[model samples]
Target: MFITIEGIEGCGKSTLMEKLANSLRSAGRTVIMAREPGGTSLGDRLRAIFLDSTLRIEPWAEAMLVNTSRAQLLKEVIRPALERREDIVCDRFTDSTIAYQGYGRGLALGPLEQLCDLATAGLRPDLTLFLDISVAFSRARVVGRANRQDRMDSQSDAYHERVREGYRSIAQGNPQRVKTLDGSLGASELLQAALVEISVATQ
Candidate 1:
């Protein structure tokens, strides 16, 4: 199972990813949990640079760097595990580029999708859970965090709103593969909602 979780920052993807992994492990499934702009040593370096709030990056540059990290991750971690028949749960993937760079930064979608296809070699999630939240709650959750905001996190409300809208559009376009969850709901509810789709996907 190649499952990817995506959403705007502060949308509780990390929390729910943890729960999903644990549940799968409890059921004796070998789950490989991975995150991106990360998941390998090279990816970590890119992640640090990509997430640095103090730095400014051009839209194309941002797309290139993150996809570079993702490419490294696919080679180093994601593919091998899948070949071994291990279930993989990934945090963010190609759709993020479309949402963030293409939608949020107003980059050209056609090229961005091409970059994504090149980076992932056409491998896509078997199931995608998009935790949906409004920009206002997204802002509140992000602001309340104790850690300093990342470059993407520090983007303006309008940018985040556009990203959220992009996610909605992506979900609508790919309904068979992606399911949108209401992030304002409690964690357990979100987990149950996700598991419903997981059950169908796995069956």
Candidate 2:
């Protein structure tokens, strides 16, 4: 099973992924945990470039770079894990591209989806967990936890708001595959909800 956890920055995706992976491991399931933009060596280089606030890039250029990194990651990491029949948990995936580039950057989503489809050759997660949170709450979490912000994190509040909307749209459009979770809950509560969803989906 390929499961992706997605949301805006500081939405607790990473934390929840870790908890979920541990839970699955304790259940005797083979699990592979990974993250986008840096799952492979080449992808890591692209991740550095994409996340660095120092470099100014056009929206299209940024989109292209993210897709390129994804192409490499899918081939080198994601596909291989799935082939082994390992349960895969990913921090982010194509949804992030749609949210960050298509919505946040005001770019056309059709072309972006097309590019990603070609990159992954039609591969997609079996279940996508959308950790829903407001842009203000997400930003506050980031500010309180970290001293430094990435290029994407440093984006304007308006951009993050658009990204949050994008995530909502995706979840609404794919209700059967995307499960939207209210992330304002306590960590244990969130994990329990996610595990219940995963169990139902897999069954």
Candidate 3:
């Protein structure tokens, strides 16, 4: 199974992804946890450049960089793991490009979608968990983080709002594959809800 978690910065995706991976492992499944703009040597290098807050990357340049990472990740990590019958839990995936660049960066959505298709070679997640949160909550969470903020984290509230709405639109368009979860819920509650969604989808 391929599962991708999608949300804006500070929406608790990494936390939830960790719990989800552990839950699946406890259930006797061999799980491979991965993150976008990463998951391979080349991907990691690209990730550093892509996420560096100091770099002023153009919208198209950002799109190309992430897809380069995605393509490498799929070729080097994701596909081979699936071939071994292991479950893959990813922190972010193609939908992120659509939301971040297409919506937040004011790029054309149609081409972005096509670019994602080309990058992934038409591969789509079996299930997606969208953690829904307010723009204010997202900002608050990002502000409270102890680690260095990335490029996406440094974007304006208006940009994040557009990205959040883009996620909503993506969920609405792909309801069967995208499950919306309340980001405001307690961690344990959110994990249970996500497990339930995965259970039903995999059945």
Candidate 4:
């Protein structure tokens, strides 16, 4: 099973992913946890270039860099895990490229999706968990937690709003595979809800 957790910045995706992986491990499932844009060494270098707020790159360039990192990560880590039939939990996936570049930057989704599909070699998560949270709340959380913001996190409010809406659109289009969760809830509650969703999806 390949599960991905996605949302806007500071939407508790990492926290929830950790909790879910821990629970699955306790239940005797061998889980492999990874994150996009930096899952492998080559991906990490690409991530640095992509996320450096001071570096100004073209939107299309940014999108392609992410795809490059994704391609390396998928080839080195994700595909191998899936081949071993390991249960994988990822922090973000291709949906992030669609939201961040396609919606946030007003780029072309058609090309972005096509690039991502090629990069990932048609790998898609069995289930995607969208942590639904307001843009304002997400920004506040991110600002309070991070001393310095990344390029995406440093974007304007409108960009973040578009990203949030992009996530919603993706969830709506794939209701059977994407589960939306309220990110405002407490950690334990969110974990419970996610576990329920995972159980149902796997069953």
RMSD of every prediction? 0.7, 0.9, 0.8, 1.0
After TM-score superposition, the amount by which residue 90's alpha carbon in candidate 4 deviates from its true location, in angstroms, is: 0.7
Per-residue lDDT over 1-203 for candidate 3, one digit per residue giving the tens place of the 0 to 100 score: 99999999888999999999999999999999999888889999999999999899999999999999999999988999999999999999999999999988999988998999999999999999999999899988988999988988888889999999999999999999999999988899999999999999979
User: What are the clashing pairs of model 4?
Assistant: none
Query: What would the per-residue lDDT of candidate 4 be over residues 1-203, giving only the tens digit for each residue?
Result: 99999999989988999999999999998899988788889988988888898899898998888889888878888888889988899999999999888888899889989999988888889999999999888888997984688887888888899999999999999999999999988899999999999999988
lDDT of 2 by residue, 42-98 (tens): 888999999898999899898888788889988888888889999999999999989
Clashes of each: 0, 0, 0, 0
- Give the best candidate by lDDT: 3
TM-score of model 1 relative to the true fold?
0.98
Find the 10 residues in a row with the least total lDDT in model 2.
144-153
What is the lDDT of every predicted structure here?
Answer: 0.93, 0.91, 0.94, 0.90
What is the alpha-carbon lDDT for the whole of candidate 1? 0.93
Total colliding residue pairs, candidate 3? 0
- Segments in model 2 whose C-alpha atoms lie over 4 Å from true places: none
| Residue 201 error, candidate 2, Å | 0.5
How much is 75 displaced in model 4, in angstroms?
A: 1.2
